[model samples]
Target: MRHLKYFCILFVITIVFISGCGNSAKTSKQHEGKIQITTTIGMIKDIVNEVGGEHVAVVGLMKSGVDPHLYKASQGDIQKLEKANIIFYNGLHLEGKMIDIFKKMAKKKTTIAVSKDISEDQLRGWDDGTEGHDPHIWFNVKHWITATKTVRDELIKYDPDHKEDYQTNADAYIKKLEELDQYAEDKIASIPEQTRVLVTAHDAFGYFGDRYGIEVMGLQGISTASEYGSKDVSELRDFLVANKIKAVFMESSVPKKAINAVVEGAKKKGHNVKIGGELFSDAMGEEGTPEGTYIGMVRHNVDTIVDALK
Candidate 1:
């Protein structure tokens, strides 16, 4: 059934691509006016907006609080991708369901995975021996610096006329990311070392934990597509009680049910565990809020975790 759905989507994309050929002149004009970029997640959207600035117009397929693991492309999204001058995604199977769509679109357009350039040493593998590296690179500000550079170079490659602007914008953004990295280090250091364990909805913060020196655990696996049975929950509860963990976090993009169950189980076991706060994991906060941007989102998470754990 899933295979058939993907096939149907590809068929629609093929028909749209064939029909769109006649509008090449108009498409060229639009591309000439402003680079139309379609990104998969809010983090990439924010990076493009910061680096591309006024030279590019970006549309993110997934909105705030929308989990990319389960996100399916809509007809409107296909239109956006069809008309885009470039498409940027996290890659490493982050957008699990839309991988085929991205590959199909890449055949004709500039579809770049911003995470592609990160070296193997910098990436963390799944503890369960999952095939791919973790996709939550944005959690580590330094890795996001790499992604920003990738976005800058790609934008320059596609739109060389704005090369200087892209370079300048990227340099500035990278500097900010550097400062954000230091801030995270300092803030995370404030939490007592023994209580520095970060428990969340899923394993989206492995990079974050590695970068900031925190022990991270999640109720669900790396991908939300993977399920967590009662055994997983009970085990997590035991770990929390054993450590006297004060809080576990809920992700903005993930349901609270699993974390809630853990909390209830901990309570029944006579260990109180509060929901630390909602962290922006796969998705970010709303557009206008501070948590909406990549830097802001990281700062918010660091502050929330420090405040709760300290």
Candidate 2:
């Protein structure tokens, strides 16, 4: 009886080992033709799509209108992350909740923070009574140009077989970004300086404000995780009234309640402030739509701001 039990135990161990090796081989084969990449947000996914082109298969965890700051991973998301050959995120606590998971996965896979390439001095602080640098660096086209290079370098490092393709894609994208930068500058400059204030739900546009010389104000702080109190709304209403600003914008990912409060407050003071439009703040627009794309999203925001403020 003892001999039989030992034999069975050994057989089970052998079977388990063989199964593991088979799964490993199968995974390698599945990812042989193209790399499997997972990114935290649509912007990173879009960048990878532009740079990786046909050489990579990418998955984005956050969808349109999903706030990354408070997003927690589901079991399905974890599975995708585990299966990914590489993971990219706009770090600096942008995806504040997913940082731990990324750190844990870093031990086993290639995980990169794309925004880390930008220098600290170039980053702005969260004025909402929080510490650390703001993670919305993509708001500035110039900053995004640098971010594109980071993605390109990572793609080359892992998939040197597609070096030329990645480089070409990056160069093309950078040129488009340059054009976009010039366009934003011209449109924003056209808006009279007195009406250049950009007020939104949260302080997610520091880079945008700094880049284009708009005075940005948010009822809430940098992270949507923090609640915007009544006082914050009151203060923003006062700011809008004092500056004679015509509109306050809504973000796709953030709720419009805070902004509504500002509107109501301003209304009581006889200042009419309309919702400029829904701007793609933390997340992009729907997939397969122009607003769904990074460049399209930025253009949409710029156009909306210019139209409302002009």
Listed in order, each prediction's TM-score against the native is 0.89, 0.89
**Pairing residues by index, what is the TM-score of model 2?**
0.89
- lDDT of candidate 2 over 61-148, digit per residue (tens): 9999999999999999999999999999999999898888999999999999999789988989866566788999999999999999
Count of clashing pairs, candidate 1: 0
Residue 64 error, candidate 2, Å: 0.4
The Cα local distance difference test for each model comes to: 0.93, 0.93
lDDT of 2 at 211: 93
Model 2, 219: alpha-carbon shift in Å?
Answer: 0.5
lDDT, candidate 1, at 179: 95
